[model samples]
Target: MKEYIDLFNRLPNLIILEDEPLARYTGFRTGGPSTVLIPTEESSFVEAYRTIINNHIPFFVLGNGSNVLALDEGFDGVVLVTKRALNHISVDETTITSGSGISLSELCRVALNHDLTGLEFAYGIPGTIGGAVYMNAGAYGSEICNVLNKVVYLDENGNYREKNLSELDLSYRHSIFQAQKNWIILSASFSLEKGDHDTILGKMNELLNRRIEKQPLDYPSCGSTFKRPVGSYASKLIDECGLKGFSIGGAAVSEKHAGFVINKNKATTSDILELCHYVQHIVKDATGFDLELEIEFLK
Candidate 1:
């Protein structure tokens, strides 16, 4: 660990912090600390990432930290925060190119400003563009693959490469990035259409309102605890199994949305994990359908 820290410290213009708390960065708001690296420039980020990988040091690339639950014991390696160095947006007519670190909401705002449609479905998604593309994030019958044209990423050999939409192999909450662990998303190009500004804004607001009405927006939670099972909805199954409002330690199945397990009273990562497992077990036993988690767990 000392050697790893020393190697990271040698990278110029990179900000290294010891025992940095991760709760403040994640939506769950409950996690322990880890060694965090924040690069001030793209060159520094490339150097830091290469150095870590070449030295076989354990590391994870992080975006907005939305759809992940870091364990109580914390990550024992480096946390590379992409937002610190890779946030940039550019518009070329109806095409928009964005860095992976930029937030989905901010991207939507950019589209709205340029009268670009096709990104309205992402208006309220609380995640970075990288995570969105990696997960093929979607809402209201639309997904990121709808507008994505190409992606620039770091290959396994620390070489930068680009892939077009067809090669991405995108599907419901799955992408080629999930299968290739060493592929690090850097930026993406999206093809949109020109539309009326007022109409686009109205659609975005309508979707935001619907999300607020159906989701537990006020609570600290990874949105939608389980994936929508084929021919069934995970939330409906949990609700039917009488798991809504169920409590385990400081965690509870949200009364407003059975899909969410929220930190109602400073819940620990263990509490959330236990509660999610219990919900999955009960829902499966009752409905004969296995509930797959939508959020990733980091340990």
Candidate 2:
């Protein structure tokens, strides 16, 4: 513990907190405290990451905390927040380069302002650019891989590097980043085409409205709980099994959207995990389709 604190203190101009409550950082709003480090500058981020790697300490690179569920016991390592430090966005003609911490919604607004049309599908997706690229986030028949040109990342040895879109192996909510656990996403570049600003904004607004109407946005959730299975929707299967509005503790299957598991009250991590496993078992037993979770469970 002394070694960890000493290393953390070496990086100046960084927000270091001990046993910081994690629920405030995540979308589900239910988790315990963790040792968190928030770097406000790019140089500090690099220094902090390098120091953590050198010390052989366990750590998690967190973005907007949109698609993760931290356990009730909480993480026992460094939780590095990249959102505040790496949030810059620059436009070069029709191409957009953004820091990994920028939110999808914010990126969409930037694209619309620049008269770019390809990112309308991601307007309402609640995740950072880094997490979206890592998961190949998609909606409305389009994915981030379609527009990604290249990405900057930190290798296992704490060396900075870049990879083209073709090297990312992006497909169906999977990316090379999953396999390369040590590689940390830093920034990404997207190639888009110019379009009428009003047209782009109109499409973005339509998608946002669709999400607001169809999804249970009023409640706290990690977006869609389960991924869409091959040739069928996960929501339809759960709805068919009559699991909608099923409550286990404070966690409940959303009444509005069967695909979501929401924190309807003061839910615990155990409650959510139990509810997920229950849904998976019931769905598999009834339909013979094994439901896979989309949210990453952080223990």
Candidate 3:
């Protein structure tokens, strides 16, 4: 680890932070510390990722950190932070290309500024374009799969290549990327339609307001705790089971929106996991719904 650490510090466009708190990066603000690597350019990012893979160094790629629950013990290896490293964007006519590090909100804003119509559904999603595309994230009947044209990613062999929408195998909170965690998303290109700038802005604002009104935006949460169960909504089931506002330590089911498991006060990672399992147990026992978490629990 020390040799690799030294090697990373000398790499171009790479910044290294030793013993950095994961809490500072995650939305939940709970995990412990680890060495973090931030790559400011695509080549440096690819090189760092390749070196870690070849050297068998454990690492996790992080984007906006909104859809993850990292353990309190934190990772022992490099935690690659892409929030700044991969935040690049460009537009050509009605097509847009963006680094996986750019936040969904930022991507949406870019689209709106260019009068693009198709990305409004993702305007307020908390994660980055990579995470959103990896999970096939959707809202208000629209999904990333709808507008995504192709993606550039580092394959298992550390070779970068382009993949089109159909080749990615996207479907409802799942993608080939989920199965192949080593497949690093570099950037994504989208095909969008031209629309009135005012109309796009209005739609983005409307969705953001809906999130504010219905979600516990004031609290720290991993967005929706559970995926929408077949033939039913997670929030409806949670509310029905009398679990709204149910607290376990500092973590609780959000009263504002039952779909969310929020850090109400100062919750630990353990507290959040416990509350999530409890909700699963109650929801399954009461309705046979077998609720599944939408967010990942990273340990």
Candidate 4:
């Protein structure tokens, strides 16, 4: 990674460090250390990409890490995490432009503040804007694709480009970025319609309350464990398989929400992986439908 060294040397705005524990920075609370941890800024993203490209080093762009499972051994390459910086948002009429590092909860709050009616479904959703766009994250039948107008992202060649919603191919929690690892989301524009401020806030709060009531918020989890299979729901299928509250070490299929694999207490990455394997095996054996994992497992 001489290119990485060269890039790092030129990019001063991004905070680059070494031997950082990823678990301490993620929502799942389990992951090994990383070789290099770089917190990037909008101005430095291009240069950082240049470093990665020039060095020919594999890199990971992470945001909140809410939907990923990092192994105990950790990652050997560079980890470009969007956390502290990238927190800008602007609204004009019904259009909202957001940085990739902004959290979904915060984004919902922004929308509510502006009396926007489109983002209520994202009120309690974890992860950042980049992750949401990559997954087309949705709840209550609303997705990022519903409001997204265009996306400004870094393509494979380290050049930034803007893509319209039509090019994203957004479907059930899947986008062009999900299928193509080379695309790195930088910012997005969402178009919402005006609504009553109080009504929007109330709706957001209502959805948040619903999430709290149904999901296991007491434990550390990456929300849903499996994707909703076509024509069926993963939670209902797992619950029907009689695998709720199942355990493997410190990890357990949430008693409250079967679709959520929770870290009961002192859970290890190994424990989480084991429980996921068990859930998939049992659910497949019972229903003959392979449970596709929604969580990205990384090492």
Winning candidate number (TM-score): 2
Candidate 1: deviation at residue 164, Å?
0.6
lDDT of 4 by residue, 1-299 (tens): 43345557667677776678878766678989875555556767667766787677778888889988888888887877766556789999999999898999998888888888899999889889999999899999888899999999888888889999999999988999978787788889999999999999888889989999999998999999899888788899999998899888989999999999998988889999888888888888998878888887664
Report residue 46 deviation for candidate 4 (angstroms): 2.3
lDDT for 232 (candidate 2): 89
lDDT, candidate 3, 9-94, per-residue tens:
76899989988889988878889988989998888999999888988888898888888888899888888877777888999999
Q: What's the CA RMSD of model 1 in angstroms? A: 1.1
Q: Give all candidates' CA lDDT scores.
A: 0.91, 0.92, 0.90, 0.85
Query: Once superposed on the true structure, which residue ranges of model 4 sit more than 4 Å away at CA?
Result: 1-10
User: What's model 4's lDDT at 208?
Assistant: 89
All candidates: CA RMSD (Å): 1.1, 0.9, 1.2, 1.8
lDDT of 1: 0.91
Candidate 1 lDDT, 156-255, residue by residue in tens: 7788999999999999999999899778899999999999999999999999999999999899998998999999998899999998999999999999
- TM values, all candidates: 0.98, 0.98, 0.97, 0.95
Candidate 3: where is the Cα deviation over 4 Å? 1-3
Error of 1 at 185 (Å): 0.4
CA shift of 104, model 4, Å: 1.2
Badly placed stretches (over 4 Å) of model 2 are none
lDDT for 211 in candidate 3 is 91
Q: What ranking emerges by lDDT with the best candidate at the front?
A: 2, 1, 3, 4
Q: Which pairs of residues clash in candidate 3, taking residues 3 or more apart in a chain or in different chains? A: none
